[model samples]
Structure formats: structure tokens, C-alpha cells
Target: MALHFSRDEFASRLELVKARMKEEKLDALLIFAQESMYWLTGYDTFGYCFFQCLVVKADGQMVLMTRSADLRQARHTSIIEDIRIWVDRTNADPAQDLKNLLMDLDLLGSKIGVEYDTHGLTGLNARRLDHQLTSFGTSTDASYIISKLRLVKSAAEIEYAEKAAALSDDALDAALRLAKPGANEADILAAMQGAIFAGGGDYPSNEFIIGSGADALLCRYKAGRRNLDAVDQLTLEWAGVYAHYHAPMMRTVIVGTPNDRQKELYAASRDAIEAIETVLITGNTFGTVFDTHARIMDERGLAKHRLNACGYSVGARFSPSWMEHQMFHAGNPEPILPGMTLFVHMIIMDSETGTAMTLGQTYLITDGPVKSLSRHSLDLISV
Candidate 1:
């Protein structure tokens, strides 16, 4: 088996899920989230755009239902032994096939937990699945069950995260070195991505968020290219993926001397991150950390420029977004725990001045002071 972790590790993860299933009185878990499958059985594949399901029974048995193309993929990357293939046709109902498989397992009329909040399980497929299970079994939304279980990092997982963090620092260094007046934004992006691949890193869950001037104020990535301004600001946010685990980093680069307002915002962002770090310990609620970050920025009169939340959980993931369901949002009552990895970014954008300053890095919560994953300096870079 070409599993990422040892057999014992995989077994431990399975037991964790089964324990949760027993607590919830679920007979089986119909997993549609690609990340959940990867975490449980080392099942790695980008073919989740098509219909797929990994069924985990309460007793410990596991089965995968996917297209014929992914049958080999399951064997090569996962520990799942019972693989069933559904044929492709003009009008194929994989959901029906899943129901048939459940019936074969004698789990019909039993309570089955389904992951409803993922791209792998689209609304159409979910509706079809519900219709198919109407007569076979019961399906309930248990998306957060597996997700919450994955928040705490194992030793082996932390190794991958550290490697990813190193690659992120390297990529950001390349970006800062290549970012200068007259440099093309696209070329700068190319340099950073190249640095990642050259350092043996994999593609991130989302495209690198790279922008300059007014575009920097916006958070998401957009197409097109423009030369760097002689005295402009550039913002970048990207992650390094190692064995599907991600450690993201963010920074805002100044090509020349920044204005007074920009300097003030950058200082506040730096101080806010430092202050927030002091409170990231086991037993503290995430809401408290977020509130501390907000108060620091709000007290600096940058409330409108700052974001509502500062960070979220990071882990092995697939496309669209790297953010896990666990987040550091105001009023959230979830308590921080050891082994949790969070990417906190102090993003401040003065829309009127068209200035953006973001300083962020990943951290691992320990028993005492949190450990920073990236070695990059927290100060805003000025070239």
C-alpha cells in the first residue's frame, strides 16, 4: 500500500472516526469530502470533480465507490481494499450505485452520516443521493464531525506542515527579491511559483493572491498584468503544500518609501499579530484571540481597514479554498487546543489611499507559547 502514513496511523484515524460514529448513533459515514478521505485512508486524487464516495462503517470496514478511472488511483494511494466502480453513461446514477452498495453491506434502513459541505458533494448529487436513500437508509449532515477531528495535528502530519512552511518562506523571499519598480506582477508571481516547485513543494489549494496598488486592496486573485509602480505597494498571499498539508504566508511589499498612513497601518498590523500571538495557548477561546486582534486594530482607528476575522485552521486540502471549517471569528466559542495550526493575517487596506498592508504567518499551538512555522521576518518588506 502506498499510504502516506504507517498502517498503524491509518488505523488510529479510522478508530477515531468510528468512535465518533458510535457517539452519534450513525451506522455508516458516507464521506464526500476529498480532504476527509485523504486524512482517513490516504486516498489522494483530484478526480472528486466526478461522483465519489468513501463509506466507513461503524464496525471498522471501509469501501470506496468511484468511476473506473479512479479504481487504480484508490489502490495506488489509499488503504481501501474494497473498491467498486460505477460505469459512465449519458444518464448514470452513481447515487443509486451507492445505495446498492449500502444494501449489499446490509446497512439499508440504518442511519448514515453524509458530508454535505464540500465541493465533491454538490447540491445536485446530494439531492440525488437523498432520493436514492429515501427507501434504503437515512442520511444526515455530519460534515463537521471528521473536520473537527482533523484539527489536531499528528507528529507525522506536523513534519509535512513544517516542510511546507519552509517552502512558503522561500517563495515569499523570491517574491520580495523580484518585486521592484518596473517589475511585471505576472513575472513576479511566476518567480514565486517556480521557487515553490523547485523546492519540491506541491500546488496549493488556491491560486496565489498577488496584486499591486488599488488591486492590492482586494483580497482575491485576478487575471492580467501590470508593471510595478515606482512607489507602489504589492500584496501577496500563498501557501506551500507538502503531502497535501499547507502552511500559508502573506506579506505586503513596498517598492519605495511608503506614505505616513501606510507606515502607521503596517506598524499596527505588526503589533496586532504580536499581541495576538501572546494569547494563542491551549484552553483560550478563539473568539478571545480574534477580539484581541480586532481591538488592537480598532484602537488604532483601522477598524474599517481590518477584516472581521484574522485566521482559520490549515490542513491537507483540495482546491477552491485552503481554509478549514474551524476559524478565528468574533463571538465563536470554540476553544483553542494544542497541535492546531492557524494562519493569522493582519490585513489592513485603506481604500481611500489605495494602500494595503498584510503581514501573516502560520503558527502551531503548543502547551505554552505558540510556535511559528515560518522563519520569515514579520516586518513589512521595503525594497
Candidate 2:
């Protein structure tokens, strides 16, 4: 098997899940999140776009119900032994197949925990699942069970995260080398992604955010690429992924010399980020970090240019997004625990002056003090 973690580590993870299940009085857990499956059993596949489920019973028994296409995929990549394939046909009902699997496992009339909040379980498929299993037993929305468990990184997971951080630094180096006047956004993007791949990194869960000129104010990835102007700004937000663990970084680079507004924005961003770092400790909550960022930015009279949320947790994830459920937003009570990997960003986009400045990096939360994952300097880059 092409397992990324040791069998003992997988077993320990499974035990943690079961312990949480016991606390919640869940007889079985209907895991639909692809990341949860991979974390538990090294089950890797994109076949989760369809109807698939990994059933984890309280007794430590496990079974995977998936399409025939992923039968070998699970066998090769995962440690799951009892794999059942549901046939595909016109109007196939994999939910019914899942019900049968539950029956075979003697889990009928049992309280089950369902991972309802994930891209792996589409709305249509979720409706079908509810329809088939509604009367089977009690099902509760326990989506956060595995996600909360994954918030803290293990030693093995930290190794991958550190490697990902190195790749992120490499990507930034490549981007800076080409970030000059008349440079193509496409080429800069290519060089950045190429650096990650060439450094033995994996594809990120989401597309890298790249934009230049007036579009530099955009935080999301959009279509069309343009050449850098003699005096322009380029915004980039990307992650380095290794073994599915992510270490994301963001920056708005200046082509040629930075203007007055650009310099002011950069200073505010740097100040806010450094201030946020002070409270990124064990006692502070996620909301505390954001409040610090907000206080600094608002005091500097840049509240209008700042985003609502400063940053979020980053770790092993599937396609469509890299952000974890826990985020650094106002009123969030999630504690800042040690062994957690978080991405903190200070983004300032002034459309009034058409200027953009962003500074971000990933950090590992510790008991004493938070540690930055990236080795690159936070100084503003102007090429």
C-alpha cells in the first residue's frame, strides 16, 4: 500500500475518532469528507465527487462504499480492507447501497454521525442519503468531529508542513525573479507553481490568486492575464502542498518603484501582521487575533481597505479550497492551541487610490511562542 503514515499512526487516529464518537454517543460515523478518509486510512481518490462514504463504527470496524472506479484506488492507496463497490447505472442509488452496508454491519436502528458539511457530499447526494437513511436510525450532523481533531498537527504531519513551507519560499523566489516591468502574469504564475512542483510538492487545493495592474486589488483568482506596467502592482496568494498538508502565503509585489500610497499601505500591512503575531499564543482565541489586526488597521485609518477576516487555519485538504473550518474572524471562540498551523494575512486594497498591499505567511502555534513556517523575509519586494 502507498500509505503516507504508519499503520500505527492510522490506528491512533482511528482511536481518537472513536473516542470522540463515544463522547457524542455516536454508534457509527458516516464520513464523507475526502480529507478525513485520507487522514484515517490513507484512502486517496477524487472519486468522492460522486456518491461515496466511509463508515466507522464504534466497535472499530470500518467499511468504505464507493463506485467501482475507485475500488482499486482504495485498495492501492488506502489501508481499508472491507471495500464495497456500488454499481453505476441509469438512476443508480448509492444511498441504498450504503443502507445495505449498514444493515450488514448490524448498525440498523443505531445513532449515526454524518459528515454533512463537505464538498464531497453534494446537495443532491446528501438529499438522497437522508431520504434513504432517515428511517434507518438517528443521524446527527457531526461534521466538526474529524475537523476539530485535525486542527492540531502531529509530529509526522508537522514534517510535511515544514517541507511545504520550504516549497512556498521557493515559489516566492521564482515569482520575484520574474516580477519586473513588462513581465507576463502567466509566466510569473508558471514559475511559482513550477517551483513547488519541481521541489517535490503536490497540487494545492485551490488555484493560486494572481492579478496585476488594476486587477491587483482582486483577492480571488479570475480569468485573463496581463503584462505588468512600468509602475504596477501584482497580488499573489498561493500555497505549497506536501503530502496534502498546506502552507499558504500571500504578497502584493510592486513592479518598478513603489509609489507613496503603496509604501504607506505596505507599512500598515506589516505593522498589523507583526501585531497579530504577538497574540498568536495558547491563551488567545481565534477572534482575539483578528481583533488585534482590526485594532491596528482601524487605528491607522485603513479600515475601509481591510477585509472582514484576517486569516484561517491551513492543513491537509481536498480540491475547491485550502481553508479549514476554523477561521480568524470576529467573535470566533476557537482557541489558539499549540501544534496548530494557521495562515495570517494582512490584506489592504485601496480602490480609491487603486493601490494594493498584502502580506501573509503560515505559522505553527506553540505553547510558548508562535513560529513562522516561511524562511523568507517579510520586507516589501519591489522589482
Candidate 3:
């Protein structure tokens, strides 16, 4: 099936890049990174090395250069104006081609921004290109220019995201329902994986997180063979990929009814999530959510830094980026914007009572407010 967006939707995306290029004062932006490529072209071939390096001219001319092998796929997938294929990846020397592409647009005298964070400049190709260019520049995060353009969802993009959200919802429901007192973490993970695939999702960016009991304090707890104890707390988080877009979600469930301490912590954490959800807005900084969540945990004497990850970028591919599109993994004071995707996972653990709990949800900044992509509840589930 050929999934396509309306012409107006596509035009908005192109305009977005033009606006960003003007802001950055760069002639044309070069993108070799998969996340950036997917964000601009909406084509995800899952090619680590075979994908094209794209250059978006400030005049609204977008050109993508990929390896010869990917020419067919690139031609079919790109929704842009120009497609250039490099017939050779190695000895043939595409440096001149890149140099020529820049020279054609009078970019030799202009600034060229390269994404070093997502696509590093440490390869033979980069060195060769560096030698060929008269003037070259690089930055840690090109996502700033990219995210500003990608944050707002068009009507068609929202339709795909909605479908992804439904798939994630069904998968989470399956995992929660299948989770039981004697079930192992592997069992839960497998069930969720099956459900996600069954629901029509293609890939998961990171390994699915299915932490249990005492292991809840550990962030990104990978699924293991450990059987769920009667009182084990299970934290579930995974993102679904459809046409390269991400619909991420997380859920928390206990093997059995929690103790008083566990209940209190769960209540506090849920309160934090709800509070953030209510107050989250386009102009609000991600720090706002983190600080408020920290306060709820502080009052309960829970270690805030124990599980320290606020949220990250959600877009065409699962880069797990922040709202600000920061190059580094640190707090960002940038205000949220519509179409920006972020994953906020609030967690709590009390080993004294042998209970660990957490909940995560992805939200898209909207015109009026932030909307939850993960429609699941915050209530602690007991299987």
C-alpha cells in the first residue's frame, strides 16, 4: 500500500525547513543521520550505511544523495523535488560529487551545517569531504533546526500517529492482561512483542523494558528470565514504529496487591504524572515536568535521581529525543511546541517493601495543549 500525505501537509513540511534554514543562517543543511533523513523525507529503509545524505537548500530545494543500491527505494520513498544517487560508496570518490553539489548552489562561500551528534564526522568520507571543501562547519545537534520544523503534526501525520497509538494501546493491554504472579519477565516481554507485531507495528528502537520487584530502581531494566514473585512490581515501556513514526507508551503492574508503602509511592508517582499531564504546554520547559515530578517524589522520601530520565524526542524514527532537540542528554529549558513528541516516565521504588513501580507516556505538543499518545491509565495494575 502506498501511504501518502495530502499536498498541503507536504508543503508545510518543506516550508518548515526553509524557515529553519533562515533562522540558522546556513546555506543548506546536510543530513546523513537516519532520524534526520526520516524526519525530512518520511522514508525509512532502515539502512545504517546505505541511506542517502540529504541537503536542503534554503531556497526550498531539497536533494537527497544515497548509495546506488538504495536508489530504487529512495526514489520510491522520498516525497521531495530532487533525488541524486551515488553509484559508488567506496573507491569511486563521491567527494567531488558532494563538492559539486555544494558548488552548484554557490555553497562554497556559504556555511554548511553537519550533524555530528547523530552523524559523526570521523569517517574516511568525512575526512575526504573536509579536504575537498573550501569551507565546512559542524554542530552537535542539527535536531534544533530539524525539530522546530517537525514538531507540529499535520492532519495526515496525526492520522498515522493515531493508528500507532492504538497499536501501542492494544499491545500494552495484552502485556498487562498476560502478566501474572508466576509469569517471568521474558514471558511478559514476549507477549507484548507479539501484540505489537500483531497490531501492525514493525520495529522497536530500544529493547522493551520489563523491570520487576527490586529491579525497578534500575533504569532501562531489560527483560530477564527471572520469574515474577507474588509481590513483584513490573514496569513496561515500549514504542511502536509505523512507517518510521513512533508511538511510545509505558505501563506499571504488580504481581500482586502492593503493601502500604508501595501503595503510597504509587499514589505519589501517579499524582506526579497527572500533575505534569495537566500542566504540560507548548511554552512550558521540559524542566517544568521534571521539577514538579521531583517534588512529588521528594515529599515521599523517594530518590529522584534513582530513576533519572525525563523525556526525549519522538518523531519519524525512534531517536528518543528531547522536546528541545538538544544534542546532549541533559535538562533543556526550551519551551515545548506542538507536534513535539516526548516520553515522560515517572518511577518509584521501595526495596524495603519489595515493590518497585513506574509509568511512562509520550505526548505530542498541540495547538491548545499537550495530548497523551499513550492512552493507558496510571493506576498500578495487579495480575
Number of the top lDDT candidate: 2
**Tens digit of per-residue lDDT, candidate 2, span 1-383:** 79889999999999999999999999999999999999999999889999999999998899999988999999999999999999999989899999999999998999999999999999999899999888999989999999999999999999999999999999999999998999999999999999999999999999999999889999999999999989889999999999999999999998888888988999999988888889999989999999999999999899999999999998899989999999999999999999999999989999999999999999999888789999998899988
Off by over 4 Å in 1: none
lDDT tens per residue, model 1, 228-301: 98988899999988888999999888889877888898899899999989989977888988999999998988
- lDDT, candidates in the order shown: 0.91, 0.94, 0.66
Clash totals for all models, in order? Answer: 0, 0, 6
Candidate 1: lDDT over CA atoms? 0.91
- Which pairs clash inside model 1? none
- Which is the winner by TM-score between candidate 1 and candidate 2? 2
Q: Specify the poorest-scoring 10-residue window by lDDT in model 3.
A: 321-330
> Better model by TM-score, 1 or 3?
1
- Arrange candidates by lDDT, descending: 2, 1, 3
Model 3, 1-383: lDDT tens digits are 13255556657777887887787787778776666666566655655453346888788777877666666666676575576766664567676677777777677677776654453233776667667764544322354577556656666667767777777787787787768878777776787778778877767766666676666656574545677777677777777666656677766676676677767777877888888887577667767777777777777777643365456656565443322353112365766667666677776655565566677777776878678876666677777
TM-score of each: 0.98, 0.99, 0.84
RMSD of every candidate to native, in Å, equals 1.0, 0.8, 3.5
| Candidate 2: clashing residue pairs, number | 0
**Candidate 3, TM-score vs. the true structure?**
0.84
